[model samples]
Target: MSSQWSQGEIYESYVGRWSRLVAAEFVAWLDQPAGLRWLDVGCGTGALTTAVLTQAEPSAVVGVDPSEGFVGFARGAVADERARFEVLPAAELSTDAVGGAVDVVVAGLVLNFIPDRPDALRRMREIGRTVGVYVWDYAEGMQLMRYFWEAAADVVPDDRERDEGRTFPFCNPAGLEGLFAEAGFSDIETRAIVVPTVFESFDAYWTPFLGGQGPGPAYLRSLHPNTQTAIRHLVESRLPANPDGSIELTARAWAARGTS
Candidate 1:
């Protein structure tokens, strides 16, 4: 079976560190009871899984991801006895493998990467004890990529064509609510969580993409060296100039719950 788009190293590199902050905020919003069993789908380096284990004080936490590298890193990083990592895709989760119903299923910034998201939601509902799930992605109009693309547009008009290459499946709020409803979840709620992604300099912002960890990296790789240099220069000039030199990007997500 093909892995989800998030399995690629490019997407992972850009979002990996930031994922910890995202998970922490999500856990804080949940305020769920302690000792509940939790499942982390597309767990990536298990950032959200670790956050759930620590904040929710869950009885146990199991994190699954399609990337072996991510699973390996997660296993090495999160050593709590209650937490475990597995190399599995979100679509493959089942009651038998999880050993019955889970109290909550969490997928942080992962839904958009899955092509068959509705099916994945169905699987999550089937495995969840109490249908509590958190899903978030880049909001369409407010995406951080807007800054990057703006810079690219100045240097290369064709960049816009490439930018529209793939549709971000979860960029719309109504689409998210509808997906959950179709999956049989009730009491759905959506909220915006903003995190300030501060970069010390242009290098600080651009270096992560060099690692080929996300869409930014992919876009960067597609450009010629001269074009890439021009894009960076334009981005730096367009950005708010500051001595401290930082950029703030807002992340929005939807949280929904139900009883199975």
Candidate 2:
């Protein structure tokens, strides 16, 4: 089944909060100076774009995504005139309305979702002097999603196909570095950004799945009620929860950067 992105609030309830934490760290790692123009490719809900505005003091931030609802949500969420959101795909971004090129371009947690990823990188290179991206290490580093998918795969054999770890091999360091090299980028580098993914209760961890935004949650909602409960039980049984009903774990995102 395909994923729908019209429900911005629901997505924020699930992944956007954690994405913001990673965005801050991603920008900090960039360590660029203030007043540089920034392009945020696949800027879902403006999490990374807002992080750059809040953390980097960029002269302007242009965010591009294919979903109108996401662009609208980001436009309303961040009112700074220095930031702008567009309902366009990463591969189609051009010079901004001011006819200006960006100093840096980055994608946060969105590269794996773009269909024509190599084309997207080439297009990003056209808009900036430096390009970079970061994605959740869904295979083993993002403990929250790893638990959900592992539990789902155990209960539903077919659900393994929908696991992002299986679908998006490009999320890893070697895979990303290969992409940059193929795209003709120089001075390439890759690193990891770690963020905490803690849930206060089983409900806190499971209720977000009902939002049905991403692939895992979409697959969860597609199941029969009893099957869904079984998967939920399986996830709960595997989590490392404490006496206070909190589940604390780390999420690692692999980030890559290179010069155009």
Candidate 3:
């Protein structure tokens, strides 16, 4: 099933919350000097844009995403006059779109979703002097989706191909670095950013999957109700839960940065 990128609130509850944590670390790692102009491509719900504004202290930022729902939600959630959001696709990114040259261009947990990555990266390079991006290590260290996909495979082996780990193999460091290099980005560097993801209860963890905003949730919604129940139960069983019923896991993202 194709992933649904709309429904900002549901996406936030499902994975945008974790995206916020990863975005903070990503911004810190970029360590760009203050007062730079930034463009946040695929800035879903302004998580990365907010991070850039708060952490990097950019002079101005323009966040762009294809989803109007996400852009509207971002505009509402982020009240800073220094930040503005637009409903535009990564492929359409340009200096004119952002109003001026950008010092830094960053995408958090979004590169893998863009249909034409090379075109998007080319645009990012043309408009900004620095480009940095991050995506979940979905094949391994993104534990939340990893556990869910494992259970999904157990329930429906034929559907194993739908797992993001399989769908987004390029989220790894080597692959990310390669993309940057191919895009003519110099001084490319890659790192892993890990953060704790503690779910208050199985419900806290499982309920988000029903939100139908991303790949795992979209897949779950595609299955029969009984099949969904089976998968959910299996996921609960396999997760390492605490005596108090909380689930603790770590999410890792591979980040890459390069000079244009």
- Scored by lDDT, the top model is 3
Which pairs clash (backbone N, Cα, C closer than 3 Å) in model 2? none
Which candidate comes out best when scored by TM-score?
3
When 2 and 3 are scored with TM-score, the better candidate is 3
**Stretches of candidate 1 exceeding 4 Å from the true structure:** 1-13, 131-143, 161-166, 248-250, 253-260
lDDT of 2 by residue, 94-130 (tens): 7663247889999988888877777778878877999
In model 3, state the lDDT of residue 243.
97
| Runs in model 3 lying further than 4 Å from the true structure | 1-3
Which residue segments of model 2 deviate by more than 4 Å? 1-3, 96-98
Candidate 1 RMSD to the correct structure: 2.9
Write candidate 3's Cα lDDT for 111-165 as tens digits: 9888877778888999999999999999999999999999999999999899999
Candidate 1 lDDT at 197 equals 60
- Cα TM-score of candidate 3: 0.98
Candidate order by decreasing lDDT? 3, 2, 1
TM-score of 1: 0.87
Q: By summed lDDT, which 10 consecutive residues of candidate 1 come out lowest?
A: 1-10
> Lowest lDDT 10-mer window, candidate 3?
1-10
lDDT of each: 0.70, 0.87, 0.90
Which residue pairs of candidate 3 clash? Answer: none
What are the models' TM-scores?
0.87, 0.96, 0.98
